[model samples]
Target: MSVRDLNLPQREPSRGELPSRVTIWEVGPRDGLQNEQTVVGLGTKLEFLDRLAAAGLGTLEATSFVHPKWVPQLADADDLLAKLDRRENVRYPVLVPNERGLDRALALGVESIAIFGSATETFARKNLNRSFDEQFAMFEPVVRRARHEGLEVRAYLSMCFGDPWEGAVAVDQVVTAGRRLLDMGCFQLSLGDTIGVATPGHVEAVLGAFDDVTRLAVHFHDTYGQALSNTLAALRAGVTTVDSSAGGLGGCPYAKAATGNLATEDLVWMLDGLGIDHGVDLDALVRTSAWMAQQLGRPSPSRVVKALTGG
Candidate 1:
């Protein structure tokens, strides 16, 4: 079927104080498939990235360079990069846990890399196996080296809104942690609602602490069914970049309560209604997610994908 045959959302006139163009940072290949029980083959992963890029997703998080023991699903990161048919207009970023992961990414000629960090002490110890403050000590060299190598470094600050082990994360605490990553030469910091417990008001409060919204990206999970609303709130606060997983495919391997990242199709639907120019072809994106869901041997959790494909 052609893209025009899909039941697409009608584009309304652009309103409100939101940015005219939003950049949807697609994370399906990396974060989406990292914790899957059914291991997706290397060819499927590469094709997933290709399909997403063909759907007009400009920035695709290709995969993680973490130790295979941690995320065995993405063990073929080296081969994936070597055989990837990279597009000149597309940006493919990989997740690198530390200096060693950075080395692997650097060896593959990766231009952009992301380092994951935690906001709360409990999560830091659990996810990174280091204390909250000590985690930065580890990332400092990674960020510094990546900068020196002329690679753009992005930081992921998890548990920004709420943590399962730790209660409500203070807005100021999140701000300070995010600032540390930014000061260390990271170009963009993605504030993650790891547990998906963030509300719109809480999202506004947390984002309000940051001085520059341009350097901020919001990664929301839909565990509490608030991801899209919180994302809209973030968009209103001048954030243009959003991290979403295609077909709603990922959940935290460490944080069990964290369900899935915001679905790219769902976000695109809301953006379409708001008349936001996100450069994504909604019909094509829905089709891509639907195909990915089939590969995973499950239905997509995305409302937009389900609605468009009658899944």
Candidate 2:
């Protein structure tokens, strides 16, 4: 199936209407805490997510259903999923790295799951010990099974801009991967700036290559201080979904010098200033980030947190 097959109606843009109301998927619980050196308790993790939901975050990445041997930090994925105080309107998406991960998520009665693929062959081989086709093949059965069970799927394409081993990724490769995910019935496709090496120009160029059926989202790292700028660029290109961590908490363990993701508080501040209705409370969000930072025994990375808390 292709975008042409979807038969989605085309609409001309009107001046008053914004490109689209962006959906901010908070990745704090899963991505943020996953990289912590110290293991956070299950109770603490649940509390953090509770606060996030109270602060009006509608979409949250709750946990990753990968094997404990692979990601020990998320070893309690099933426990967390079982204990979560499920919100009717809020979506809790868990990361499923392969078919086994997907099965675990399904066993926990998860309705939504995220599958990831890398754009560059080197990154895929390095990270997953598989080539691009192999990784995609691993995802295919999981996607099919999930769809059979009526689960919503989100596909993450990592290293969309640049790879640690390969400098620049071709835009056509990204488009092809994104199209493949969409064809596999993924509800959304998140293009990740894995090493945070993306520029606004690169964002526009990458997004311009995709057709309309594939809804686009962005996941940016703040490594070179380009996350926010790239985010604004994504918005300008009509991207309606953005992924960020609460206090800029997580980074790629594979890539050296890679900073945490773009901070959620900072993103909300920008969106609020732009008169964008994100339905999130900045003050509460700042408080949540501060609490998480205290638990981790580290200073908060969010600029808005510092400014708001007088740190």
Candidate 3:
């Protein structure tokens, strides 16, 4: 019984103008574990990264450099990077909240860093402790210095479609915030459906507002069972990078309603069926997530993992 024997997700040829290749930004190591009640040890985290890299996830969000006061789970970011087995083919990106976090990452020679932003004012204040317009001021210097220091920078705009406090976020508002981050030298902008309330139409409209889709990526949560649908909309609109959590292991500490992220295994299955070239081994990914589930003392939330492993 090998992975080949599974014969899952029957591949089919591309039907439309969708990109043949997609970049799946795996966030299970960072965003996926940040909200966990139990702190996963550093050795386990390192092995998790190794397994994900072996499974062919090119870009892995390794961990966050936020202060221990905020996210104690990722407080070992410094140690994790120090002990990590760096791979030439894989890109390890860490989240740097502000100047201090960037300094920590720089001290360890981190090559890539991601900044978190908010598409709505309420989320901005709650998540970043800054006003809607004020959050940019906090991120500008960080992004600028990261670029000047020759590090790849990514921006995450949370609450893109709808916020818990704010019933519905305007498309223009998301575009404005996203553009500001992009203009500040972010190489990529990841639009986050923090509460996962976005539908296909809203996803299309939000992506359409942008002039360039090349630098855009979508990070959808499956809170409303619409992550896959919204992902299809993004692909139709020409977005090639997608953010997903392995094992669907994440939620927002700030947003009570926010649930687990779109699972990497589930996304890979859909990509496989669509004949999109993601370069990830679905069986390996499912096994990795399933193993992670055992570590966390729960079953993986990925539908594909369940279907394949009969969990």
Top-scoring candidate (lDDT):
3
lDDT of 3 by residue, 127-207 (tens): 899999999999999998999999999999999999999899989999999999999999899999999999999999999
Q: Score every model by TM-score.
A: 0.95, 0.93, 0.96
Q: Of 2 and 3, which scores higher on TM-score?
A: 3
Which residue runs of candidate 1 sit more than 4 Å off their true CA positions? 1-16
Clashing pairs in 2: none
- Ordered list by TM-score, greatest first: 3, 1, 2
Error of 2 at 71 (Å): 1.3
For candidate 3, the lDDT comes to: 0.92
After best superposition, candidate 3 residue 300: deviation in angstroms? Answer: 0.5
lDDT of residue 301 for candidate 2: 92
lDDT of the candidates, in the order given: 0.91, 0.86, 0.92
